[model samples]
Target: MTPPAPSDENLLPAPVLVVEDDPLMRQRLALVLDGLGYAREAITFSQSLGEARAYASNNPLAMALVDLGLPDGNGIELIEELRAQDPSLLILVISAWSTEESILGALRAGATGYVLKERDDLEVSLSIRSVLRGGAPIDPFIARRILALLPVAADHIEPEEPPRPVEAGVLSARESEILELVSQGLTNREIAEQLVISRYTAECHIKRIYRKLAVSSRTRAVNEARQRGLLP
Candidate 1:
């Protein structure tokens, strides 16, 4: 049975890319994309890191569902490469492997969402929509592991040396506010909407914040801010 087309105008105009080595998995993912209202011709599939990289070179992707295990190379390499190409590209890790290292690595590499292949098709579709709406769609198990990795002050544990105090004035008030929102896990699009600023303006502020904090990832920026007492 054919599914109806997507009505959301905000959905990406470019086709969704799927990088998975397994043929069956690729077909399954295509069905899921169909459920999301992506026409068959609107989907691109690659079986390995090399093939995926090649496709990404010529195409402008709106989002990619990547499998970590690839025949030619690691999928994280492709994630990094695509991220370098388009900072706004939404990358989602879809893999059977759930190692904490793999999950966190993908996120740090610029993936906006992570979902275990064992999840239901509906869940995966929901995750796609969630990320498209400017939310991180992490699996529950992965979410718990991530939460555990975050540092929390514990009275029973001995305190380490405090972080070097960062001059709060280094960032302008607006930039500081943007950083705070970034720390709260808001995407650039969401931040722009929340602050009534342009998306380009929000992105510019985020880049400036990253440079000032000397950090690459959102987690690192937030941690540095907390360590330097920039955030409470």
Candidate 2:
């Protein structure tokens, strides 16, 4: 949708816990979430996932924005615990680290979406919105990498008879690969390096993937691909 106007239409006001140590960036995130009608006033800032977990019983956690590196422990664990407790809870991971291992681990931990702190708020906001609306938010290049890592499951993966290409409007095998990596939280540069290509080329491929999938961000692409068994 066009993003809930300036007004709020969300079922729950959505108390989003923002876990970040950086003061400036934290404030910027709070502002962006507010502008997007998520709830800036209800936001709580935590330097570590430990602190966020401490308030679990008291605070109503409708959603959260987590940072990977924290003072106490990796924030991905927090997302995992919270998600397991409440499967409907929304989670978004914001981290500067984009290694294949870290990205994959976070997704496996049940993060509904992932974003790099270095990315613009447009990227962050789009990601959060997509996840909250029942889609996975991921970086495009990362999507491809995850796909490459997908286990070969014949029952899940579509069989190829003469699989030249699905179509211009359809998700190709390569795009499915990229979207899987994105779900795992890989960055464009990392995805390119892993695929042995230039960053620009990787981005162009991601754009095409997005168009074919009709998704605006990484998380949505990943979710769609998974639902279609394209990630496998």
Per-residue CA lDDT of model 1 for 34-130, tens digit only, reads 7777667667889988888887774446788999999888888888888776676778899998886798678767788999999887788788778
Cand. 2 TM to true fold: 0.60
Q: lDDT of all predictions, in order shown?
A: 0.77, 0.72
What TM-score does structure 1 among the candidates reach? 0.62
- Stretches of candidate 2 off by over 4 Å are 1-6, 11-13, 151-232
lDDT string, candidate 2, 21-84, tens digits: 8888898787777667754455778887768888654444667888888888888788778876
* Candidate 1 CA-lDDT value: 0.77
- Model 2 has an lDDT value of 0.72
